[model samples]
Target: MVNVYVLVTSVSPLTSFLHDISVVMTIQHPRGQPVKLRDFLLQHLDPAASHQALRQVKQVISKVLQAAAASTNKKLRTISRCVLCFQLLTFTLLFSSSVTPVVVQVDTQLNVSGLSNDAFDQQITKDLILEDTLHFLLPPLSHLSSHTHLSSEREGSQYGGCTGTLGISLSEDEFLLLLHFQLLMKTSSAFQPLYPSVSSSSSLPRSLSDLPDLLTQIEGFYKLKTNRSCRTDEPPRQQPALSSSQDEGLCVDPHLRQIYTDPPLILTPPFHPLVKEYRTEVTFDTMTVRIRPEPVSSACRIHLDEHRGPRMANYPVGLGNSKISILVMDGSHPEPVIMSIYTVHVYRESRPSLPMFGYHVMCSFVQDCSLLVQPGRPCGLQPHSGSQSQRNACSSGHVSGRWVVPCLSCSDNRTCDWREVSWQPDGCYHPIVDHPLLQDCMKDRKLLFIGDSTNRGMMYFLMERVNSTLEDWGKAHDTLVYRNLNRGRTLVSYSYYPQFWLEKKQRPTFRQALQQLLNRSQPLVNSNQTVLVVGGVQWLNTNHLRTVSEVLDSESLSNILVVVKSLGMGFHLPVDGIRSLSLTEIQDLYRENDDIVTTAKHHGYEVIDTFSITMGRYKEFLQGRCACHFHEVTQLYLSANEALPVVRAAGLTADVLLCFLRWRSFGPQNLPVTERPPQTRTEQRELYIHSAANQPCQTRSRTRGLNPQPIVLEDQ
Candidate 1:
């Protein structure tokens, strides 16, 4: 579906490569190009993805055999060859799949059109998306941090820093660089030879009059640029009130009147530099606009956009819209030049996207870009805390072959490279167990976890987060003493129940655990409020599914809400910078576990996706030192004698998931009556009857049984 264009000769117009065999062309910057496509890509594209592609493209370009040919065709072929090489390189990069391909548009003649409403809106958006943007929620601009929300949980007083929607940006280094470059081209004596003799196109710009033609001539080199014109409501020399944002390498802050090189600006999110919301109050033309309230974090209202994808609530002008703008409104000039200093390109997600709701504000300033521009900038790496023998723990190398760059994540234990690092609420993360409301719900109930040692270890991680007292209550049927007494009455226990494995590993059999789960002999304790988390996929054999099927058949399945945890990532071999396991082996293992996840979901069991949790480079799981990327936690505790670090890393990610786990252990009925919303008499009667109908001690008919297959194990 992608149209391949070709330019056979310098003078030839673009033609489809499929239409003519001789129309092969290389990517070129035409004389009248509007933007610097190459420079923009090189500056904004992720360094990790760019590095991977550049390495591959270099190899391919080096290997392309050369031969004699017509001058025009030879040049065209070279360009075409390199384009092919780069595309192939990016194909590999697509595994990460966040980077988007840039498409450049060029016109031989000056292309101008009357701006339509849509076009005008697009221009306004592109103009206002400056370095210090305000797309997401934020607190008011006061120095007070209390009003500010992290993940959107706080809402308080509001204010106005800017009105009339007249946005001026706090231009960053890259923007300043363009200004500095053009300024130098005009004044620097060293550039005298480059200027053509007295032609209209070559005339020096006394002001902004001669820029368009001059830019057209310069467009043949740098490809990344935008044709932003400077013109707006003017008042000479008034101080502009744009949100202040500071980037690395730039000497001048945008708040002051100065000029310097603009470092490259990256607007991609959730990686874009974090800009806190600024609050202020201003009366514009007797219209005292009331800005919406927010905190460090709050629940963002969800609305279906045109594509039906979930977007934060939209509002009118000067309101709390999910956007921020920074522009330099230089009022000091006689005729103030209003340079629209921003650009935002939103890529539409494909249809049938998974729906998500709720968000909380998180805050952090953009890390100083000096780390990038300044070479060997002294990486203050910290050693991971570890075992007694290695108290210092200063070793740069890891126990396994995984070479994670420590400077990337734990940089001085203060700064990080990513713009906004956080765990999205819906993406395998949740609220904690100690919520004021959840605590009241758990007072009269208990929480039970049934899984292997990995899941048990995850319990330990969760135990740290939710302060609970541990106990060793070894019972006969479920003999493991993996027990915790939280809030005295609420008992949390992990019993080793390796499904389908009857072999003596000195733990209870799966059948014994199931019998205990059903409480066939004893009355079900706190049957209504109790919660069960099941995870035995790692140990399930091919035919072991029958055992699980039988367990699900019991009356306990319908009476209680069950939760399943997906299998953690396994390393079969090294692939895609992760040296832990083979690609095919890991995929095969995940594929097998997918059946477990599928069955659990099919039976209406809530599945906690551990796969996405382990994947690296997501906002919370930053590019480096993540579970999949570098085995971070494993690096802390892994030793040379261990099998490998991948196992430990996988365990650690599961542990992290526990931190994100919500107290969904009890249903709505378990909520303390004081906190529970009131129901009418009729509604309460219906609920009372419903609960009475599903009594646990009662028996059910055996006529309705699932048809599980026979235990055929000959292949083994």
Candidate 2:
């Protein structure tokens, strides 16, 4: 009766009124008779409900009250079943206006003998899927590469890498489930932003001027709260040490069980299972305090007052009883179907501002793991010794697999086994571009690389590979060209972009670099033999992508191959005063990357995402260089006591070149299975050429001064 009264009077303030009413209806009356629904409404229904609640709900329920008022003069409105039915009808109408039914389909391919759709929907929610995927065990980090704890049976599994956690292997069903939810997760507003900016209205309290006695009190509370140390067992290799207070018999005081009070600090079990513990160690009179995550959870978002970021384990902590909110994707069953948000009280003794020298040390050596530790194979392509021409022997354009280094005991660690492994794409094989293959691939072709230093690096590798006599390579933002006058007669050019690479006083107008590319006179003029790869979208804006799409849409360039290189992961190192990209910055980059990929595909251009190739090997970024640059891998044929031509380019550069080769050799028909778009420029052009040949004869000039070649489809 109280619940019913509360629902009608506080309709505007009560967000969960429907849920409360449902509970009230299920309660049995003290008397052994059914509760009189008509009498109940007459006693509890308030006029304020009609004035305050949803207009549609108010109108529907008001009609029932008017009908009851018409019959109020009757002496005994006794046991009429119709009155009870009408009361339920009023609720149904109110609920119908507020709630819309959603139809759930598990999977088109999921065939089960007796599983019902409702049961499937209930069992596998969006939150459930996310929690499961985040919980999937990851391969150990690079420092733990030599740790031999992995079982012998799991030795054949594919994920292996150093330094970072980026790749993972999933079964087909798991992959489908993860992919389905990921698409939905991106559109979901249920999950809060990992690092949201603090609002002006809810400003945090001023930082403690000096180290408070609260640090000692908090530590003492933890020590006294438990009988023994919670952490006793050694954690898995490369994983942080985690332990639960419940395991140590810490009593749960009902008074302190406040997940709804100010600050919402609930320091007890029903604690987030994904993150078992958060431990803080103070040293050197609080001059260097570190907070660590004790579990293998990678998706934890840490918030300390105004400062916020994801995966902020081992970061510096300052003085005071700081309110720390750690959000992780873990099943807090029988609770809300959302990512678990836990608030813990951490006390540290230090200044809030981190010094640059200390920041560098923490980021370089002490920071055990990053916020986002993607589970999969390590960065770069794995080495393969098999014949290169076998179909099904190479990998997709985005290569996978692990590097196998043989000489671990050499005195010079740098020279220790630079090249025991050979480059191989993961699934199907295309011949490696040797001197002869290079000539055949680029014979009379024009290759243009447009973007930043990364693309320039690839051009340098190809140039050196094309001409062994070349001695030096230049690093500048200029229009430079190389022509192979002897063997293939190929022309390779590099064009820097975004106009910011130029001096401020001489910068061109917006997108002038791309505009010039399209407006320039063509020397080769043969669209069929031209290939252009545009990269460095990390610095590009949406306007740049739109301009690029226009170039791809030009009918004169339709037949040429154009590839858009996706953004790669940046490291903690700084380049030209620019530090590594923050997680928030990376999110923005991803949006731009998606726009570029969509724009590229809309105009039949190929896209190659190098994020996976560089994400896991971020630690390999040489000091004093751009955080985006990676170290080069030396090519050594140890079996034959011979060395291959030393490709001075990095692993990313080599893999990108291999991507083009794979696309050219297979021609899209034999592409390796991956989640990216299946169609390439090669396939689109082939279809166009095939269709054009069947049509009526027509004269179409390809360029200014060349014989118009008839549309022809020939077997390569």
Candidate 3:
């Protein structure tokens, strides 16, 4: 009777005592013909290279027919006729219902692919993979091997009350001798301590300090026995399991949108007796994910970034939803531990050209982080080109525009007003230029300011617009200098780099401080009133713009005017007093800040482009102390609307207040400017926010209200 049809589909009633094993196997077929045990085990078994040893010999014949159906002498013993080898096999079952039905023979003439042509060259000397031999046909039900702790009314009436059928009838050569006795009960390490609760719950502990808490308590005991719920005949009642650090980890790549994970090597079972059986172990080298924030019905104005590469996390077009985690740890263990954890979950979707302004500013001189044209404008409507393939093609031209607030300023009754909302960068009408036409276009300009503290907040915003105040400025990184002697002594200086073009021994590098400020002839004055800005957010390279193209082809430093800033947007929140910054070092600081803004615009310099106006204003930074700076009421209305300079009450800083109205686009048009076009002309261009009494501020409320508090950095 060799018609072996054991069709077990979705079988799990904890293998309902594998329907009392009525053994009857006999097979000889080397042409005795009549074969059809699924067409002779599909012409000699190879379910893509051995279906994990035919599913562990159907789990050792369902634990030897559940030990003879939990025997009271239900009997079945004597299973020892072995010599199998697809790569070493042996067998035995020793059952007991008085040992009579033992007819188990299998001969099908040695090899027609029934393995042993050196089993695929010993499965490539056991490096094995078809997902490492289907990891023993899906083992991780928290490493399954239950020791009959069956109550909850007998495993909920044996997994939802009875569903029958187990008629055993083996033949395709005794199903290849029951897959070589399930690969000798999965590679017998002396039949694994004769099942001491599956050798202590599938053993591993050679102490890597309790292997991540025993692989998180065998993954929360196989997720509490597969989240139990078997209520068909209603006996369901056992819950309590959880703790392995409450176990929420492992969710990996749910259709990825930059939620990475890579330090993984957790293997063990190719016949695991711990250590060399399918071995694997990188333990961990470095992985760190944190994220956190998720309470949203709107207000967390999202902005994540975490990257270490292979896209670990970014989420910028804001709205909300977060939860990162990842961790991993091991640091070659001198006390580093944390072995594994993973959870990802992010979500964004808001868009209509997302800006709802929290804050954004990078303008060291708006030098094209793409699209801002206007200077002899003809690269065919500037399809954004500082070249290197159109520099991020208009990188969201600084949040396209909108955020207004306008008339509202009380003191004692509380509307104190942080210059009440005002960013306008979509198109470009930006008129308002007060403070004596930017202190008469910095009269005889020198403006140096080296790097960090966002280029000394554009030299304390053009020394509070040409000396209306900051006579000294001091946050101590040194070099200071502010001049303005009633506005034309105009000087400015600022040095403080705090290590930008990093070489650092006692400091020097930015090509040795631009060769000591071009061998100082007292403040780089070749004339055409010296304008040397230099930029920040610290790291910059094309060898610092080839030392600002050898100080702009020096004929004794050719009448100065250098610029190059470009790198804004850095909030990176994982919250707890803010200052974070890791989307893998903000993608290696935007590929070397867009390759040093395309080699500082092929060596000519002058490029503020506050990274497309603070790259969608990184959820409006300024949460206090320095969540990457911006609010002195959005840097006094981005320096009174990009350099027309008027608004006053100052405090937080870095959007380079449009690099002081981009130093009136490199000085001397004799101020009073006008522009005016955007009403519906679209290709994008309308940055207008007026009112320091220059009037025009009325688009109220697209929602704003953040108050986290801590920004006092003052010294500019």
Task: Point to the candidate with the largest lDDT.
Answer: 2
Q: Residue by residue across 274-359, what tens digits does model 2's lDDT show?
A: 44344332321232222222222322222322233333322222222334454443222333222344555444332122212111
What TM-score fits each model? 0.29, 0.36, 0.27
Candidate 3 ranges beyond 4 A from true positions: 1-177, 180-350, 354-402, 405-449, 452-496, 500-506, 509-515, 518-523, 526-528, 531-571, 574-616, 620-716
Angstrom error of the Cα, residue 618, model 2: value is: 0.9
Query: Residue-pair clashes per candidate, as listed?
Result: 55, 17, 34
Per-residue lDDT of 203 in model 2: 45
lDDT (Cα atoms) of all candidates against the true structure: 0.29, 0.37, 0.36
- How far residue 429's Cα lies from its native spot in candidate 2, in Å, is 4.8
Per residue, candidate 3 scores C-alpha lDDT tens digits across 1-716 of 22111212111111111111112223443222222222233354564423333234335544543453356122323433232321111122222232211223223222122223433222321222122223323324543334322322243332232331222333333334333223323321111111112222355444323222323334334334434533222111211111111112222111111111222223233222112122332211111222322110111112222222111232221222223344433333344344333444323222122222433221112222232222332211112211111111111222233333221221111221223333444433333345565666666666666766666655664575456544444354656555544445567666655452345566666666655544442646665467676776535567777867675576476556566676665545443333566666654665566677777767765565554455433444332223344432122222334422221222222233332343344332433334222333121213322223112221221112422212233221
Model 1 scores worst on lDDT over the 10 consecutive residues at 14-23
lDDT for model 2, on a 0 to 1 scale?
0.37
What local lDDT does model 3 show for residue 208? Answer: 25
* Order of quality (lDDT): 2, 3, 1
Error of 2 at 99 (Å): 73
- The C-alpha RMSD of each candidate to the native structure, in angstroms, is 27.2, 28.0, 24.5
